[model samples]
Structure formats: structure tokens, C-alpha cells
Target: MTRYVMVADLRRCVGCQTCTAACKHANATPPGVQWRRVLDMEIGEYPDVRRAFVPVGCMHCADPPCMEVCPSTATRQRDDGIVTIDYDLCIGCAYCAVACPYQARYKVETPRFAYGEAPTESEAQRHEAGRIGVSTKCTFCVDRIDSGVEQGLTPGEDPEATPACVNSCIAKALHFGDLDDPDSNVSQLLAENQHFRMHEELGTGPGFYYLWDRA
Candidate 1:
């Protein structure tokens, strides 16, 4: 079984928010929702303060809490390890949202556009009709990944098949690949770096990793 994962190289991130922009553009999310974001953390004392950017979103946990708490069975984890929400099945009870510690799940009862209440031509093109009153979050660009695989293209290595956030990362801080493959870039990167996954104590077995102070 192939497990997909993502890695963020903390040393390389510049907090440019390119990944955020790319994700919004790709998913066409409304104004208040951000599928991906870079959090700025300040370290050290005030005078010696230094900043670090931590990119966060859905972790795609091996033991997804959202899936466990979904009353409608709307949340599912694919064989490839991508966690997705079935909009049609979701009742927007927000149980999954409450269960998710990452705060990745979102529900919107009303439609919203970037500029105004009325959706623009471009906004309407990508707007998901069934998304209203349903849970939504990142899909790890599964459509792109699946399509790329069908076309015999390597996802992590090929820009076309990779996640928009990864492709838009100017600092090359983001990496996506099959963690089950030892030879994959993500696997090799993890093996050679000092990395840590968020909230490991929760026993969620998150697939997202943060690499810093490389070995």
C-alpha cells in the first residue's frame, strides 16, 4: 500500500505565502477559507527575536479523527492516503470539524465570492455546487495526482502532477511523494533529515512532516 505524505523544510521556507496563493487559486476557495497557510512564529527574546514560518493544513492523518467522528461517513481516506470529504454525504453538522485538531475542516452555509456576493465568471467556473452546507478541505491535489499517474507521470517529480502549493513554492520548501517507497524523494528526505510531525502524541500518525536543522 502506498502512503502519500508531504514535508516542509523549515530551513528553506521564506514565508512568502506563495503556497497559500497557489492553493486558493487552484481550489477557488472563498474569501475567509484558506486551505493552506504559513504561520509566522517568533523565537528567542524580544531583542534577539527571529522568525520561522510553519506551513500548515490538513495533515491527512493515518488515523483520521474526522473520519471517525463523521456521522454520515462523509470523510474517507483513500488507499493512497489522501483524506477527502464527500460533499453530497456531508450534512454540515461540523462534527468532523470539531474532531479535527488541525482545524482544517470548513463549512459554509452561504456562498461567497472574492470581490462581492455575486460570483464572477472565473469564480463560478470553479465553484463546487454541492460544497455549500458541507465540509471541505484540501485533497492533496488528488485529481492532479490520479490524472498524472494515469498518464504515467511522476507526481512529486513532475510539476504538472504535483500539488499547486508544491509547484508554486519558490523556496522549494515543500515536497510531496509516496512515503511507502524507500527510493522516493520524501522517503529519502526524511531518512536524511531531522524531522518531526505535528501532534504525534495524539496518535493520529500525521503524514505531514516538518524538517529542520538538517543532519
Candidate 2:
């Protein structure tokens, strides 16, 4: 009953977007398809206005609408709360993308590179052929988690097991851990802070949490 989750501290985030760059490099996502992004939000009136850099991506909900709407059954959720897409089974119908409320899904119809028509050596080496012409989203670096577990390491505590975005946060704003474990980092964060989830009213049961204030 290990439920994985991420917690982002709004107070600590500086909108540097290091997490975004780390995600791009780790996942080798094509241009215009950002699996992880920070939304620069402005709150309050003119004199009291302030900016909030909210890091967001796939929520990996307990009840994912994308999974329910997938006609091909390409989208699936693991027991640990990670949502993944099977490119081979996907038909590129974009049904899951349409059903997603967070707009975290992307459908790249053709192969594109950062440098025009040609891909750089690094891009070519890391390019995933299966990702083309299919819906793609963040997996929270499940491979790292799985491998780390096999090696007797604790995810979220171990850099090799943690999500790249969480590990790359310069401000230490992002956190990942098991929500089901009360002693886990994410669980402690939620218990000690005033936090909220995006679109929680929809009842998707998103695993991503935002800490707005100390409790």
C-alpha cells in the first residue's frame, strides 16, 4: 500500500526552472513537449502583487481520467500510484489528452529536434522512438525508483532513485516520497504545512501537493 507522491513548497520555489531543464534532459523529450513545467503565477493587486512559481506535471492520480478514457487501454496506473502509457498499444487518438484536466499529456505526431530538422548527437542518442506519435507524460522516473528498490535503496532518499526534477531543484522546493508512510518526507510535509492540490474538487485524487504555508 505504498502510495508515491510529490510535494512542492511554494514558499521555497524561485521560478528558476532548473527542474524543467532536468526533466527535459532526463527524459529526452522533443521540442515543444514539456513533461514538467513551472507556471509563473501572479497573485494579489498591483502594490501587493507577488509571483509564484508552481512546478507541475502529471499528477499520477489515484483515479486517473486519462486511464478511463483511453480506448486502447494504453494508459495504466501501477500499485505505487505511477501512471504510465504503453506506446505500442496507443493509437494516437488523443482521447487521454482530451480527458486530462491538468493538460499534462502531449501527442507528438512527427519527430522534431531542438536544432531544426537534424537532431544533435546527444538528442539522437537519447531519443525514444516509441514516444513519437503517442501521448506522453511524466512517470516520476519510475525506472529509477524500480531499479533503486531492487538495489535495496529507498526512493526519495536516494538520488539514483528519486525523480530528476526533485533532485535538480536548486531551491529544494520539490520533494518525492511515499504518502502512505507517515514518516516519509512527503507525508511529513503535508502534515506540517498548509497544502493543496490542483483541481482536487474534480476528485481525481492527485498525488501532487502544493505547500502554501507552515502549519
- Candidate models: Cα lDDT each: 0.92, 0.94
TM-scores for all candidates? 0.97, 0.98
Which pairs of residues clash in candidate 2, taking residues 3 or more apart in a chain or in different chains?
none
* CA lDDT for candidate 1: 0.92
Looking at model 1, the pairs that clash are none
Candidate 1 residue runs with Cα over 4 Å from true position:
none
Q: State how far residue 27 of model 2 sits from its true place (Å).
A: 0.4
Q: Which residue ranges in model 2 land beyond 4 Å of their true spot?
A: none
**Alpha-carbon RMSD, candidate 1:** 1.0
lDDT per residue as tens, model 2, 1-215: 89999999999999999999999989999999889999999999999999999999999999999999999999999999999999999999999998889999999988899989988999889888898889999999999999998998888999999999999999999999999999998898999999999999999999999999999
TM-score, candidate number 2 = 0.98
Per candidate, the number of residue pairs that clash is 0, 0
Model 1: residue 178 alpha-carbon error in angstroms:
0.6
Q: Show the lowest summed lDDT stretch of 10 residues, model 1.
A: 152-161
